[model samples]
Target chain A: MADRPGSDQVTTLDTPIRLDYHFSAGAAATPYLRGLAEGKFVGQRCPVCRKVYIPPRGSCPTDGVATEGAEVLADKGTVTTYCVVNVPFAGQSIEIPYICAQVLLDGADISFMSLIQEIPADQVRMGLRVEAVWVPPEERGPTLASVEYFRPNGEPDADYDSYKAYL
Target chain B: MPAAPAPRQGRRPVAVVSFAQAPNVRRDTAHNEVELLLPVIGEVLGNLGITKDDIGFICSGSTDYLIGGPFSFVAALDAVGVWPPKSESHVEMDAAWALYEAWVRLQEGDVDTALVYGFGKSSMGDLGKILALQLDPYVMAPLWPDPVSLAALQARALLDHGLATERDFAEVAARSRRSALDNPKAQVAYDRSADDLLGEDYVVAPLRRHALPPLTDGAAAVMLAAGDRAFELCERPAWITGIDHRVETHALGARDLTSSPSTAKAAEVAGVSAGPVEVVELHAPFAPQELVLCRALGLPVDPTGAGSTSVNPSGGPLAANALMAGGLIRIGEAAARIIDGRVSRVVAHATSGPVLQQNLVAVLEGA
Candidate 1:
């Protein structure tokens, strides 16, 4: 190997990233989050397809049309499917062995994932009925987490045929 | 501005004459991006018995996030020594898309030949964290869901829909890695069975370790010459018959996770079904994604067996996935098969974003 001045020395740079960003929730999501703070389930329906999207979207994906009006939906939903969290990860908020479910809220077209507790991870299955257990009013804010997690609402399990399209 | 060149009306025949790529590696501590690309670019043009001045336009594909700096492609151009300032352009997508751009430019008739390349070094940052930034910033990025977890969600959906099983995913990985044993440039190659791969624990539930691609640092280049120029450059050039791309909604929940409808749309537009496909190269980073793409493109579910349509003969992204270059490598690899007189018709696919959200398909034929 050819030698040069400081050839035996190795230098490295440690660049720590620190940056701030402000994101707009957009025309649809701003109102949805605000409604969540007030303990309300807000969604929008596509005028063409007539399918409702919760935590609302500015545009309907299928019909390529804007969803203008907001609709308040029920807090109850059915689990379309779920995955059992067996391994731990960095920056993970939920505890190990927790259940993460794609909950299809009533009157909503698309499902969103959230934590499911008060039920053993093994017992969580598709079509299981559930409802949001919101935080106390004082703790409510502009976050979906205001409804901490979903729990079995004791309603009969939804028929598999109901959410077959969603899965 | 100078007077615009006259554009050709119908499709102009453009053929991939030469292709080359750097050895795939987990981490390249010795060379930076330009250093990794210089030799690959040189070899691709040199092998064709031509110099950079012989090309009319040069285009590259790369991303700034991986470099942790903006305008990284500008420095990558230094590898080609783009003196005299030849016509050039860039896309922040895979080099396959850059090849697509160059092909479109060649259709203008003025430019007889063009060069396309893609490069990336995924070793520099936490790729999982960097990839999360591509999601919807307001609703999804705040949660910071990793790509593996998102792919697992899709995998689970595929399972529930009766489209595939966990064993099927393992088989794809096993076959890909086994095929990679024949490829010297492959980053991760082994003679493992599907059952042995199935014994591994899930990285994210439903996705075993084999389902994931090895993060790679590599570069690849392709030379495109139009019509008679293709005949002048080589004996058998992989002439591009058709090329098209399609993208789905960015919101993960908005589209059906079980199927890749965008790939289907692009394949239809590219006339992938017009003729029997002898060789197909797919850029599926995840093993399960291969099944999804095959179903979308109307190809065989298991793209194995020598007589049938051979898929991923170069071992594919499952062997060495170098971010932006992986897709372009599929193109180069497919072209090499045709150039070597092993195949006549070939189909190559490239995917970007997450879970096969965006797809580009090209059909290359030998004359």
Candidate 2:
């Protein structure tokens, strides 16, 4: 059964609310941000499970223990998973048909998302070796953009068994 | 619905066995939500010589607006060390509502023990802006009225109608601060007299500096167990005999500000008057709301603490009010007295939303 509006008395109004806030990246990301400023990569190691996390989560996600000891990580890693971006929308910074992937950094227990450039979008695949390309020294600061993007390192692709667990 | 609902007769018995809270502080600069709450959870579970495995269910309450981020409760779960994936739930309101959810789950009989906790940091953001988002979106919230202004309006109503005097508010603050001398976890505690507090300037008419709760960044937790599990863990378990919650009209103009009919209705449903209430804990952030609550609940007042019933021996919310945890702390404070063999019957109340619009009442007893 269906009912249609027959000169019904219903009024519609639009209301909008805006709230501004200051965000802190918290204890784990603070050190990581500092590391980025110096063109260095760092991670936190979970004492309970010994899993190293990049951009260092304050607590070990699996064991829920306060992570200790910042481990310096390599800029090179394997692409555990990836997608080719084709759609264009508002605030589109990069050009279309770019590659974005979850890069499992060397010595990191988990994979993090990043952009892959300097290689054709179609060539980007799972287990591809990649390295961070730093921006100009003047542009480098406390941000992920300091390393403009990841690029193919021209090394042999990683073995399937190495990053299968991350997928 | 059953006419004139009778008291629960054959329901399962649940008791609060252990409780822990982070030391109340104006700001916890070094610790994030995970670190701030980790010790509280560890202490609550460790006090009973148990671990997360011993917990059957987990529930927490908190809002993300404090940090202006989403999934704050999920990040807060890191304090629990959730190995093997425990069954859990969360509420965006006060942790008292989380405890209520856990209590309802316990009534189902499958779960024997549950861990309930709440944490918040008011100093992280503009509390006034954060609180304004909770009002009626179309008509009320747009005004962007801060909480103290709203509480001041309620206080003004109390004064204009002679429901209470300004000195009575001062006395509530003075007695709360004085009683807090023995509480190691209170953020604000002193031996200030009511006459001294009256000397302070008013934040708003009928509301002074001492009348408002401190902006506290803290966390609190409670452990609940049913029947034998509770007795085995706690020497004197505070068995919760009655628990109920009720809500009233959201539009402030449609309701009375000087009285809390929602609290009265909730107290009735929870059977608060069935036994002598030896302790009463109300989550009244402003000192004047305590007078309103006492009037609604029909409880005798002895602010000097010489009478049989003691109110806020833990200094209540006037000492330290952590948004998400304030109400749960009230329940924990009341239960602690019963667990220590200090009291027989206690009524714990928690308020949420605007101007005490929603109220939860629980009656705990000692065998």
Candidate 3:
């Protein structure tokens, strides 16, 4: 026979599981987020490499040394590189076609992803000048969401050679 | 560049005497992780006419993220039926690294034979979203940048730098899938033209659907025996001549996306260019990545041609990427060819992290 008996056929089971976890902000991140609450950008400088890390990291990935000394950085930075996100994904909070730019904060050596808004998605290019647009003071918290989004600051576009290494 | 730590050399000869794998599929709803791995483990030992008592050590590779539980690998040990007591270990990394650990253990002369396995069922949860957790928690993870999107950015950079083109990517996919036709374990075997592949729309810019590896559920195992034990176990054992691994900074923007310097460094320490390679099993999950790896390993352009090195004869990861197990499968596939007397010298490679940030290279030789 082409078909198998119902009992002889294989059975499949579905076990639903969920994992809920709470991650703590370490020593470097605790102060970084606290600074964000007061509308200031704080970064950590690697003494050996002399490179500034935005949002601060406990250890420099290159030197494997615990970074010390907090460095306050300006809000404006250059968009080193970016991708125009078009696909929708589960747990995604932003609208499609939004620009995710890797912003290298002024005086920071590393770049981090943030939303680029108040400009057309196609116009959001590398080397574009951008500044943070923070949420209202009452709504501000010790989270990246404290900055609503970044918008063009209308400064002259940075030259390719200045931020080429970041790309 | 700081030299990659060299693997222990001039040690007792160890060889992969046996290898086995489960059929790769898009989904296997009928079995759980333990159920899925049991038969695969049995076949590996059964084919060699050996059992747990004969194996000196046991190691496995799996990710808790796949099953969404702590110590998932501990439960997987039930498949091995580790009764009484046995020397065992586990790695959160790919099984290739587990094999590396076993190789190092074998060098101590305490273990004569070792068994290594890796498995992952990517169907249980949001595979892309789960992998995104591996990114930096402070910045990258908060944005939830999926693996494919990150790889696409690498592909875009490759194009911007004039390292590769969209057609070149399609060509790699076409060749790999076509090569998988003879491989029973391949899940995406096909014979299609590169032009037809290029006709497909982009899942992410600069990367067409053909360039992506298919999501697969599978398990693979390799048995390693040292010196006399290897000759007794296999007719012609694939001896481990050299092995090494190297890693780069995890910051994606800190390194060049168009090339894999870590792989090149690993290959140098592994002695990949010492002899003529007859086969290469590259663990490149993306099409363009294959080109990058080929250059890194210094393989000839016409790799698969007659009298030249054959690349991915088992179809590589493009056909069926079983997450943590995929990299280990490359090692097993390469050894199987040597055991079968099809090749004399072979190189197997494995990679981890975003955009090939880390790489492992191992050279195998046949008598």
Candidate 4:
């Protein structure tokens, strides 16, 4: 194979860099993301307020109770609101100008942000129907990226008031 | 809707009674975060005739990415000798926010006094790339736009809006550096003229080397006690009369870079009324930021007014930018004014996120 682009050349310049990091797995968020990779969405429900969190948190924000057990949620959801990512960032895998939407899945009280792909950026509506597209079963990771991106489900447009709380 | 009963604003009565800090140097090879903080915390506590055990609560502000480590605050806690497992918390924000959290805890009435500290070693990492992480992860990060470039964008916008000039920015830097000469703890202290600064090459458009802060490694510790308890500790306690913080949307392109609405909103909520503010310590890492903050606070752009709130008496962050610790230092410097009897009333300001996207302001008074 030919030498890779940019790697084929050598230069005399040396730029010094350093990494000083203390790594904590943020272990609490692991199981929730893990559930997504397994084709299921899990959230922790607060016993006091009975609010189901999609990306289950360790503690409930309102009642301040520890979340217990897994509450699987329906993968299908309606887009609440979204913005087009016209700018790109470091370590980002997605291309620029993609739609990042807040999807409120069924059986979940709150919506989470994720990328919406396979649709025109300008055409992506606020209440469009979308479904999670999971990665190949053998390549799952403990991250939201495990679900590649939400795709258009070709369902009827959701009423604005139906998912207005998510915005 | 009848004024909502004042929301019980909690009665922790915490005032910053004592503060101490080390000289912010560009490189601190002799000490790490803990080593830099231990003595400062000791000195601050000592000044109040108290010990570490006297602190009922502890909180720290720091970022893991600053030193290329996650949970960097955890290791720095060893400096405090937290053996008895104190009621403590950590914010990924600046230590100034940590001070705010401590103030909130004091309101609960359970904690009489709290120790708040912050430290950062920006020398150990790529400070610019690390700061980019503070932006929206999806859209802004992929462009790899370093902080200097973003600050330049703000400077350009200010120029386009005719709100300021490149010479104005250079003058701010020159004055800040001159002010730092009086502050022994300042990292970058030099006597330079505005014309000389304007002659330097631009690191980014409209931002010269003099207009940027020096990368620094340092730590600061502040002691806060509630109400009468504060009066007992110091002859003049910097009573935090009003404190509030607010955040704007993280999207850079969506924000108006020329103005810090968050700072103005926070100042408004903190009850920064129009008056002769004796001293105002603002955390402006970039020189142009000082102008933006002054405008947001409704203070005169020039620091020469007799009753004007003197911005950055400790030379501010342009003297030394220590990332997570810089904001807390501003509060400490403001509190020092009250302790030294130099000012009867002052305001301490802190900021986080990119382009002044979030701000916390506290109006302090000597009691």
Task: Give TM-scores for every candidate, taking all chains together and pairing residue i with residue i.
Answer: 0.67, 0.94, 0.67, 0.68
Report how closely model 1 matches the true complex, as a DockQ value: 0.01
After superposing candidate 4 on the true structure, give the runs of residues whose Cα lies further than 4 Å from its correct spot: A1-167, B1-12, B303-307
Model 2 C-alpha RMSD vs. true structure (Å) is 4.2
lDDT of 1 at B216: 93
Per-residue error for A7 in candidate 3, Å, reads 69
Candidate 3 wrong stretches, greater than 4 Å: A1-167, B1-10, B301-307
CAPRI docking class of candidate 3: incorrect
Best by lDDT: 2
Write the residue-wise lDDT of candidate 2 on B1-367 in tens digits.
1111222522688889999999999987777888788889989999899988899999999999886789989988877878889899999999999999999898888989999999989888999889988988768988898999999999999989978888889899998988889899998999988899999998977799999999999999999988778878898888888888989888989989999999998888888778788889899999989988887777875445566678888999999999999999999999999888888789999999888999999988886
- Model 1 whole-model lDDT (C-alpha atoms): 0.85
- i-RMS values of the candidates, in order? 19.8, 2.0, 18.6, 13.4
TM-score of 1: 0.67
Kindly list the per-residue Cα lDDT of model 3 for residues B80-163, writing each as its tens digit. 756556899999988999999999899899879999999988877787778877776555666677888988998888889877
Model 3, position A105, has a per-residue lDDT of: 88
Off by over 4 Å in 2: A1-16, B1-10, B302-306
DockQ of each candidate's interface versus the true one?
Answer: 0.01, 0.46, 0.01, 0.04
Encode model 1's per-residue lDDT on B223-330: one tens digit a residue.
Answer: 998878888888888888878889999999998988889889888888889889998899999998998898888998983333478878788999999999999999
List all candidate RMSDs to the true structure: 24.7, 4.2, 23.2, 16.7
Candidate 1 segments whose C-alpha is farther than 4 A from its true place: A1-167, B1-10, B303-307
Clashes of each: 0, 0, 0, 18
* Predicted candidate 4 versus true structure: per-residue lDDT over B129-216, tens digit per residue: 7887677665677566788898899999999999999888988888778888999898888888888888999999889998888988
Worst 10 residues of 3 chain A by lDDT: A15-24
